[model samples]
Target: MDEYFERRKRMVERLKDELKISEKVAKAMLEVPRHLFVPPHMRREAYNDYPLPIGYGQTISAPHMVAIMCDLLDLKEGERVLEVGTGSGYHAAVVSRIVGEEGLVVTVERIPELAETAKKIYESLCYDNIKVVVGDGSVGYEELAPYDKIYVTASAPKIPVKLLAQLKNGGRMVIPVGDFVQHLYVVDKDEYGRVKKRSWGAVRFVPLIGEEGFED
Candidate 1:
């Protein structure tokens, strides 16, 4: 356990430097046990800086990418965050820790089996603030409307307008958009219904499949 923590600490340090995130976010990365969210077979590679396959045709986002996106979202304690594509539940777990009990993290996974497994992991880890739903994530979770922050893990051909509607005033959303190649898009909505969009860089992710996402 000591070695595992040490490795994660080092990884977090590297992430802080590489991703240019605050120390608080770096600490969150270190504190969240990535190994617990991964499969036992992949536990040894948990601290690696790259994404790892987590069954169900999904892969956990790389640490650097996660740090970059989280930092870009500018998450704060007690903020309501919506996460599209829970994948292995690693990202949601990280957000759960950062947001703490006062905050709420609603994560949507399109696959039932993956949602079930991730729910078990969240329960075992005692992340009571996170709510996992098994359904099409592109439409956004309506019951938990008006999120302070939104993150779309899967790449889509374009930003989901429905998701934009769910963002509170002055809220931000990070999404990867494209087909063969993707770019990280940061979108911000203001009180007057004006939106600002920016591109971080190129990235590749599994296609976000559903209404408001890819056609196929």
Candidate 2:
């Protein structure tokens, strides 16, 4: 655990130097034990910048990607956040720390196995602020509609209106949009419910598959 903690500090340093991530995001990234979310065999590489496979043909988003998304969303303490893809639960775990105890992180996972594993990992870490839900994440989780912020870890054919509708007024969302060629987008919803978006840069992510996303 001490070794992983040191690795996290180094990782955060790189993120700050490379991406200019905020202190809040950096602290959250450093605090979450990424090694716990990954499979036991892959724990050694947990603090590395790249993504690692977590079974079920899905990969955890790279540490850099997670840091960038969290920065884009501008997550604040006591805010409600929605994560479209739970994956290894590492991303959600980082988010949980930023949001703090008053805030909530509802993460949706398409694969039942992955969702179950994520839930177990959250329990082990005593992360009560995050809830792991098993469902099609493309459509967004309406039960907790109107999130203060939202982020999708996968690439979609286009921005899902369902997800946009779930973003609270004056909220932000960051997602990867496109098929063969994906680009990261930062979407903002104003107080009047108007939405504006701009491309951040190109990125590669597993396809978001469901009703409002790619055809599975």
Candidate 3:
């Protein structure tokens, strides 16, 4: 237990020194127990700044990557957030902590097994504010439309309009777009539905598989 706390502290420092991370993101990183999300064998390496495979070819994104994405999303308490992928539920857990009890996080996972596993982890952590669903995340979850922030965890060939449509006015979305390679794009939607897009940098993620993404 104390070891996990130490690892969390180390991770927070890594985010601050290595990346231009926001304070809220750093706080979230420190609060969530990342070791619980990774497999037992990988717990010792959970704090490392690198992506680790969970299972089913999916991976929890690097800690710094998660921080950057969270910072770019600009999450606020009471905001409605949507996560396109729930790999190991680690990213969602971090978001859950930042959003507080008022905010709600709806994460979609295409793999049923992974979704179930994530749900158990969420329950164990008492993250009642986050809802885990099994579906094609590339299509986005329409039932919970007009999200204040949207994060696509996987790499897509293009930004799925369905997700953009789901973003609230003046909302922001951070997604990695590309095929063999990917670049993180920060998209903002204005009140008039005008979208402003900018690329953060190159990134590599598992392919987002679904109707709006790569062919499964």
Give RMSD to native, each candidate.
Answer: 1.1, 1.0, 0.9
| TM-score of every prediction relative to native | 0.96, 0.97, 0.98
Worst 10 residues of 1 by lDDT: 15-24
Residue range 78-97, candidate 1, lDDT tens digits: 99999999998989888888
Candidate 1 RMSD computed on C-alpha atoms after optimal superposition onto the true structure: 1.1
Task: Please report how far candidate 3 places residue 22 from its true position, in Å.
Answer: 1.5
lDDT of candidates 1 onward, in order: 0.90, 0.93, 0.92
> What lDDT tens digits, residue by residue, belong to model 3 across residues 1-216?
598899889889977988869989998899888989889999999999899999999998999899989998989999999999998999999998889999999999999999999999899889999999999998899998889999999998899999999999999999999997789999999999999999999999999999899998
Give per-residue CA lDDT, model 2, range 1-216, as digits (tens). 588899888999999999899999999998888889889998889889898999988999889999989888988999999999999899999999999999999999999999999998889889999988899999999998889999999999999999999999999999999999999999999999999999999999999999988888
lDDT of 1: 0.90
Clashes of each: 0, 0, 0
